[model samples]
Target chain A: MVEAWQWVTKHPDKLAGWTLEHIWIVSVAIAIAVVLGVALGIYISRPGKEHIADSVLYLAEIMMTVPSLALFGLLMLILGTIGLKVIGFLPAVIALVIYGQLPILRNTYIAIREVDPAMIEAGKGMGMSERQLLFKVKLPLAVPIIMAGLRNAIVLLIGITAIAAIIGAGGLGVPIFRGLRNARMDLIIIGGVSVSILALVVDGLMGRVERWVTPRGLKRR
Target chain B: MIRLDQVTKIYPDGTEAVNEVSLEVGEGELCVLLGPSGCGKTTTMKVINRIIPITKGKIYIDGTDTTKIDEDELRRNIGYAIQEIGLFPHMTVGQNIQVVPALKGWPKDKRSERAEELLELVGMNSAEFMNKYPSELSGGQRQRVGVARALGADPPILLMDEPFGAIDPITRVRLQDEFLKIEQEIKKTIIFVTHDIYEAIKMGDKIALMNEGRLVQYDTPSNLLFKPKNEFVEQFVGADRALKGLQLIRVKELMTGTPPLAKADERVVTVQARMEREGVDCLAVVDNEGKFLGWVDRVNVGKGETVRDIINRSVATATANAVLSEALSLMLSSGFKTLAIVDGINKLEGVLSFDAIQLALSEVAQRRGSE
Candidate 1:
């Protein structure tokens, strides 16, 4: 423990830089996943499109069942075969984003479903067009649930991001990978502890953001 | 004013929800569409607002074919309230009430003022309730908010689908009373749907009873009770149609002239003599201006005391405009044979007695028998 703490203290600047990089990559991946998932969820959830929604949800569930490491390796090989660069951040991010899509898409579908059917009737009865009902009533009510999905994605991606360093993504995962190659117990412990601390901080902040964005009437007192 | 000429609605699953039904509701009239579950009353109402498009036939609002006007615009001009209320749980009472006005792009200050005015109109304390969410309110309060929201834009037409059906019986009665008062003031052309016959009789100027996706009868509550066109309507209105008919007669119709009154300052002996001279056990005590103070029962009078001191202040009373049914309930509940009918300022206008109510109903029965 003393040796690990010493190592962390000795390379504070490098650790900080890598932690920032890790946060950036995960944030981007999650952001993209959210946009794509929410759009697709809304599309499939429309009337006459329920079967499509079910099919998409089933596919997302199957994607979630695939092991993340194997998915990443498959993506790396596909990118290499396609003659595209596969050694660094792009493949890592693509893997994280693909892995992040299932929760966001599934949660968005469930959240939109959670909106009261009576509310939709009320909206239309009160003269709201389809667009207005979706934007003003359905989306606003679904947001808190969607944010919860985002929170899950954030935590999951934060953990998965550490693994991204194996492909030269240069995150906090670098130390753990280097320590594994050299059998340096101190570096390994420092990486593991910092990643945990990083996850905790991100999770806490995401929770606050979720609460802030939620409608006050829907909030837990 | 709203008119429906042979409207029909058929669900996509080959179910006929509303058959060809033609109806007309005059301006400022409270028209009730009443029926049992799956009787197509709700479908008929939804067709008015274009929430459910009619499968056949035409509907006109103020002589404009509904399909000619923009559906959204047409709907915005018509107020709507439903059984479940559909209050946005995430909004405060004030925000919920301001929905239509806000949708119409009324200035914020005006919308806020309108919300407060509507809250007061619905008998909720605006300052106290404006900031509270729907979940914070009881079912009755939320229903009130639903009504206030519907009236926010002050539209000339209102469409209500069992709006009070979810409230408890007691609250439903109170809300019915409050809505009647509001209706007298606003005079909107209202189409209210309900499964309860009593509610339809109490609130509607004309009741349209439906069954099997078709309107069976459309007429005034009294006409529907006294002049049923068929056995279906007679059975639908039930066995106590006469009692329901009596509820439509206001106290103002059957009430007799006010009884002799004693001034509040009159000596108890003098009041007692007045009651005895009038051959009555009690005399109403009024102020010098003839405003009703209360009533004095002979048993409570003391020779040395004044009428004010001997009066029963807790006696049940009714307004002259109150329906005979209201007086009947009040008298029955309080064990009073007569109800003092007061005017707006509590001045004694007349009295409603059990004899007068009996006489009214018996006369109607006699007229029917002769016919």
Candidate 2:
């Protein structure tokens, strides 16, 4: 860990770029996941979604079952032959994105569906149209739960992003993977420490957000 | 005015929630739908806003064909509050309250201003609460914000579904009283749904009692208590209904202690002549301050004594919202036929008599029978 800190201090500029790119990939992918996942959750959680939602959920569950590193390899093969030039990190990101869905989709489905039926009745009684109820009441209340899912997704993605460095997606993991291959203990410690710290910081920030936004009634902590 | 004509709701699987319910709520009247679970009280409310679209019959709000209107537009015009106090956790209280107004296309300032005013109306400090998130508030406080949010756009109709159900019993009663005060001021056409018979009788101007998807009775709270529509209503409304009826009926509605009114300082004969003319045994004494000095027993009056000498200073009073039992209990204990209705300063307003109570009961009974 100390050696990793020395490495971060040793190559501040390189660390900065790697950090930025790594975070950028995680953020963009997570952002896309949130939108698509929440939309799908809402769509699936609604009444009469029994068959369709169950099928999609089954597929997501199956995808979640694949090991992350192996999934990345599969994505590499699938995308490498396509016109995609960002192939090195492509497989990594796709695997992380897929991995991120378990919590998010599960939470989204629960959040949207778990809104008190009485509250929905009240929303309707207030003369709120279906659209108003969905976007205004249902969506807002679902936010905390959705955020919960997102929090898990983001932290999971951060940790998973490090392993992608093996495919030339040289994040902080570059030193970790490269050093380990050459049996360089110092470099391995550097990459390992940086990834752990990244996960810790991201996880801490999401904890603050959850505390700030989750309804006191629903607040777990 | 809101009218439900033979409204019935049947789920897809063929369970009837509300069965042939027909009733009309007067404009600005607070009508409570009280029943046990699965009694159709909630379904009746849903049918009004078309949440669960009426499977049979029609609903008219202010005499309009409500069923023909777009559900959302209609909901925007009516305020709905729930027992869960569903204030959107993601939004500030101000934002939550501003929802309907914004959707109604009011100017931004108007929406926010109205939201603030509503917060204040529900006893929340608008400045303190407006920017704070919902998670920062206590359960009772959040419920108040929920009410403020519901009342934000000034909808003529407000629907409350066990709005205080989640709160502690003490808080529940407090919220109910606060709501009653708001109701007195706004006089909106309200449909409050509750399974608690006591609450329904306490808060409702009129109570609609339901059983097994059927409306058992629709009448004034006191009337429903004094006269149950059937064994179902009698059983549902509870055995202590006569006592509940007294609580439902207010002192003003039932009392007739019209003590002789004499100015603060007047000749002793002024009290005498008025007492003789009104045929009152006692008089309510007042001062130049308009403060109630107490009561004047005619027995204490002498041929040439000052009014002060004649007035009995030990007087009991009741406020407008004081339940009938309190005043009646006081009157019975004190051995007085009249209970003074006064404000906080103890200024005399009116008096309560058995006649008033009898009158309210008879009139409500007559009206209920006619219906």
Candidate 3:
């Protein structure tokens, strides 16, 4: 561990680059997941669309059950077939976005669906159109819960991004893979610790964001 | 005025919530839709604003067919409140009250001014409560905000479904009285729904009593009490309806206009002689200006030199505008069969007696029987 610390200090620029790469890839994937997941959640959670919601949630659950490495391999094959880059950042991001779907999608769907029914009734009775009801009432109340899902997805994707190192996507995962190849326990500990720290910090920030976005009326007195 | 010409609502599952109910509510009149649970009073109200689409029949608001108006446009023009209050938790009290006006594109300053005015109209302190959330308010306060929100755009018609139903009984009565006062000032045509017969009696100018999705009786509260249309109407109004009818008639309506009066400076013997001549046990004592002083009973008349010295100053008194039930309760509680009615400045108006209440009840019963 001491030697790994020394090596990290000796190669500060390399460490910084890898950490930034890890953040860049995970951020991109989560950004895409948030937009796509929220839109799909809203579309499927509409009244009379329960069957569609169920089917979409089922598919997301199946995607969640697949091992990250195996999913990446499958993505590689699909990308190769389509003549796109099958390794590095492309497969890494594609795989992370897939893994991020379950939490983001499910949370968005549940949050919107579970908004107080009385609020919707009041909005409609007050002459709010469907679009206004969604944008003003339902979505605002759903923010905290949806943010919880986003936080969960971010943490889960950060940890999963480690496996992207196996396919040559440079990130915090690089040191752990190298440590494993060279049978270096300290290097593996360093990589594992950095990933854990990154997840914790991001989650803490998201917690602040969740509280900030929540309406004052919803906060505990 | 609003008219429902055989309005019917049959849910897709074949439940007949409202079955061809026809009624008319005059402009600025408060009409109460009253019934037990599952009796379709709420369904009847919702159909007017098209919240629940009618399966058949037509509804006209101010002589315009409701179907001819767009649903959102129609709802915007009709104020709606419900039992749950249904205030948006995400919005402040001010924002909630500004909902309808904001939707109609009122300018910001106008919307806010309207909100403050409405909050005051509902007896809430606008400056203190405008920025507060619904959760921060008591149930009664929330109901007040709900009403202010309903009256947001000041639409000519208001629909309220048991707006005070969720409050504690004591607060409920106070809210009912306050709302009635507000109603008098605004005079918006209103369709109020309630299962409480007393609320219907207190708040409605006309009551449309329903049973099993059919209109059993649509009449004044007095008629519902004294002249029920059928057995169901009789039972729904309850067994003690004659007593309840006391709530409908004012003290002045039943009090004798020319009650015998004894002057405060008159000699006791002279007052006693007057009471004896009138064949009455008591005479209301008044000063030279006709301001009520008290009463001088025959027993007390001879006990003092003048009516002033013999006057029972602590006798219970009621305002002329007070309902008979209030007067009767005061009389009963004070152990007096006769009650003095006075105006705002203690001026003698009339007198109420137990005999007069009995006569009123018997007259109603006889009239109903003859019909």
Sort by TM-score, best first. 1, 3, 2
Q: Looking at model 1 chain A, which ten-residue stretch has the lowest summed lDDT? A: A63-72
What are the per-residue Cα lDDT tens digits for candidate 1 across A1-221?
A: 89988877898998899889998999889888989999988887778988898899998888878877788788889999999888788898898888888889988888888789999888887888888889878988998989988899888888888888988888889889999999998888878888899899988998999999998888877
| Selected candidate, larger TM-score, 2 vs 3 | 3
Strongest candidate by DockQ: 1
Which digits, one per residue and each the tens of the lDDT, describe model 3 over residues B1-371?
89999988889999888888999999899999999999999989988888888999999998999999988899999998976549888789999999999999999999999999999988889999999998899999999998999999999999998899878975775677568668878989999999999888877899999988888899998788878889999889899876777677667678887488889888988888888899999988888888988888887755778887888888778766566666777788878788988764678888899898888767766655765
Please give, for residues A123-197, the per-residue lDDT of candidate 2 as tens digits. Answer: 666656667788877877787888888998898888878887877776777777888889888887766777788
* Interface RMSD per candidate (angstroms): 1.0, 3.3, 1.0
Provide the TM-score for each candidate, comma-separated. Answer: 0.90, 0.75, 0.84
Which candidate has the top score in TM-score?
Answer: 1
Clash counts for the predictions, in order: 0, 13, 0
Which segments of candidate 3 are over 4 A away from where they belong? B250-371
Model 2: lDDT of residue B190:
92
Alpha-carbon lDDT, every model: 0.86, 0.78, 0.88
Q: For model 3, report the TM-score of its A chain.
A: 0.98
Of the candidates numbered 2 and 3, which has the greater DockQ value? 3
DockQ for candidate 3: 0.53
Our tally of clashes for model 1 stands at 0
